[model samples]
Target: MQCAYCTEKAVMNTPPRCKNHFVELFEKTAHETIKEFNLIQEGQTLCVAASGGKDSLALLEVLHTQYPVEALCVDEGIAGYRDTSIRDLQAYCTEKSIPLRIVSFADLGSKSLDELNPTHPCSTCGVLRRKALLQYSTKYDLIATGHNLDDEAQTILMNILRNQRQLLSRIGPKTPAQQGIAARIKPFYLIPEKEIRAYCLLKQITTNFSECPNVVKSFRWRVGEELNELERKQPGTKKNIVTAFLNKHYVREEHKRCEQHFCRRCGMPASNELCRACTLITIGS
Candidate 1:
């Protein structure tokens, strides 16, 4: 099939575009999303939460083109998984001359995720990872994550299914700063996971395609599989899910307000006296 805008053969089915056109559309969408959300302002420091995965590397490549950005990675200390990814991240940051910072669970005085032996590995790792990001990214104005449309959709669905109104409310392109925590932005909020992989390939960004061995044990894995099946049956399902969530007035209002307390142990933003990370660390210890 011919590309919708050019004579070249189409490589993407959605909107029917060739390689060049598809890459162009993918990048343009990210820029548009940033502008639409006002995610970054002039002279503001931006840090991308690089995991050395396709999505994060793709985001770093795109955003670095127009904005001065740095890379921050969390080493969960999972053997063989995080190590390989960190190597790729280091190489990319070095080649681009972007400063890179890494924080590990060990740095937090807690054991590595693999050694933690938590009952819920993914959930445990997530809490620690967020803490690591926030703790180390205090110098940045905003922290950009590589959360693509699929990840956002999965999160929305998970929150809805679990009736987590507070979390559901916060799912969006950007999250405002609360207390001492840095604001977070998702430039790929509208970009699809497949498109991100394609962008990485087209741009020849260094990425580790390996999946975390613990992913299959998580609730998100099940939801993602179900969501993918639904999307296959009905295209645009993921986008619709996010759009509908964003259109809810209650969600928008809720996002504007948050009740935050300081973690007594770490002095970080938390709903309770102890942040989730501190609590997890206590439990693991």
Candidate 2:
């Protein structure tokens, strides 16, 4: 049978069956969440974090279809791997005429990805990227990520498992509206990983299929794979978890109070003695 929202006359024999139908679902949820969170106001400039991966590419496409978006790309100095991804990201952004800014791990510090703590290069990369993006404070009204439903669910479960209730509370579609920090929003917060991959396939977006080679050894990867398997065994599990997170738990305006002071080490905003970025860098160094 043909998909509900597909313009194509041909049909694929996949379960849940509709290729374009999921796009519509994704777009609807995206728009609704954007509206509900007031994530973007008219004439606002938004920055999208494009990792040259499927989820991020799809996010760029969807956002381009709706609002004005600029892209921020961070090259983690992963040797050839990062260069290739950066070229792909820049090419795609150039095609859409979306302004792109490139930052390098070397610029952030002399350290390369391999030079960091072997156990967690991702945390370092994330911190540096955040610091770089924040430097572009003038151009962006909001910051967006490609994190989908699966990511949110995984993070929530992981936080709960670690008994980090405070951190878990902030993992939502709309991160709390904190002052001085650019409001971060995830339009694809309700989307599933499989559906996002499908949309990328249908739209022919270029993406790196290989998981981040560095993170493969991490505990998070194991948890992520377990979650993926569980998702296959049970549909809507991610959505259900996210819904419960929203309904049963509410993130108060008080959550903002945590980062009221600036990190003494890095001068970035922070609640404790150090910002996450500074903490990671210091620990790694």
Candidate 3:
């Protein structure tokens, strides 16, 4: 097959790119997104939420090459899942000389996964993980997550379905959740998942294939399956969904309308006296 950009042979088909071109394509697009979104400045410190998965592994590679980055891993204490992921992250960070900070579910409170009580484990686990990541991310100038196009698209659809206009407003690269929190950015926001996996394979980056065992329990995952089918039928549906939201002039205005105040309990940003994490964590197990 011939390359789409040039006459060099194509190494990937679906999108149609040559091996070198494919790599270049991925790198160039990420850089472009960073520039367009102003995701990272030249001298700022960056902390990545690396989960030892393909998305984050690929994200760390690109960011490490471009800036000084410290990797932070949140150990949610799930047996055989988060433990193995943190181990993978630890090894990779050590090998690459990147600083890795591990904050655990147990460290914050209890050490064992069995100790937590929640009606929805997967949903609760996600909240816990985000709280942990945000808590640890306090020291950095910016927090970069590995969320890609597909992830963003799925989230947009879910929020729209639920009429979560407030959450939908916070979909861009530099939207900080609340005061005192560095902005959250996703450099791969425009990159497709397929390309990330291909880049990981091409670069030979070591990453886990096994997803979190409890992922099937997520409402988001179910939505993702349906979204994938929609994407298969209608190419660029994901991009279109996100693009439409991002293009709205009221997005930033609506995001500012989030009205942040500190959580009286844990002191993180909260809409009420207690943050969602603090409120949820306090439930009887």
Candidate 4:
């Protein structure tokens, strides 16, 4: 398994950190997606959803070093774990001089994610996080997340298995901005999860190791494990899967239907009359 760019070293090793090579590889790939999808402009304010995990940390680092970016973290009000992750994230941001913002579920008047009525806390947390990110990011023109190829592949397969056609249509490198909100972008859409983890390790970048405290056992975990196994068996399987879906299965026009519109309830760009965040609150209310 030779390196994708350099054929000398095996792809799995701690790759050499040549600034030129690194910038060239990332910028070229990112520029291609940016051009193809019109993801961002030169002067756009980019907000990165930094989860304090390796992937998001790497995302923040890359964007801060390469482009204009602000690191945003959402705290789900999981008392013990959330504070620890925030402390570390703050330290990293302060050390690097990266602008940072913290939004808590408390600030949004939501209780702990574990207290949500939904069986899967992830559903509530995700909706709340997105809402907070959108609310806090007034100046940014784009919101970038650290979703890598492995995650994308796992999610695509998960959606397809569950017959989630609409969700499948929404899975890609680019997605519509919420009405009056910055568009979403995934610059690392082609990069594999393992590669991101490896890059973090090689760079010795510090990140939070805590998993989501309230995450229940779910099918997505099994799918993630399966994807990891497949990656081990066939290098680049995740990238290949995402590329295949983006090139062959993904329908741009069909996904355009997923475009964000103003929610009647919250006035936020939503897929429905009430955004997911408002709906969750209403259910809990």
Worst 10 residues of 2 by lDDT: 8-17
lDDT of each residue in 1-285, candidate 4, tens digit only: 456566444435435535345545654665577678777778788889887787788788777876877898998877677777788788878888988888887777777675664577666777898888878776788889888777789888888789867676558887766556777788888776656776676667776555765554666777888888888898777778787888864457557665446678767766788887988777776
lDDT of 3 by residue, 142-236 (tens): 98999999999888888888897767655766676465676789999998898999998998887777888778877889999998899999988
Better model by TM-score: candidate 1 vs candidate 4: 1
lDDT-wise, the better of 3 and 4 is 3
List, in order, the clash count of every candidate structure: 0, 0, 2, 0
Best by lDDT: 1
| Model with the higher lDDT, candidate 1 or 3 | 1
Candidate 4 segments whose C-alpha is farther than 4 A from its true place: 1-37
> Which pairs of residues have clashing backbones in candidate 1?
none
Query: Residues 139-169, candidate 2, lDDT per residue (tens digit)?
Result: 5668899998888888878877887655753
Clashing pairs in 2: none
* Top TM-score hit: 1
Q: What ranges in model 1 sit over 4 Å off? A: none
- The residue-by-residue lDDT of candidate 1 on 77-183, one tens digit each, is 99999999999999999999999998899988889988987778999998899889989988889999999999999998998799877675458888888775778
> How well does candidate 2 match the true structure, expressed as C-alpha RMSD?
2.8
lDDT preference between candidates 2 and 3, better one: 3
Q: Order the candidate numbers by TM-score, best to worst.
A: 1, 3, 2, 4
Q: What are the C-alpha RMSDs, in order, of all predicted structures?
A: 1.2, 2.8, 1.8, 3.3
lDDT, model 1? 0.88
lDDT of each: 0.88, 0.73, 0.81, 0.74
* Weakest ten-residue segment in model 1 by summed lDDT: 252-261
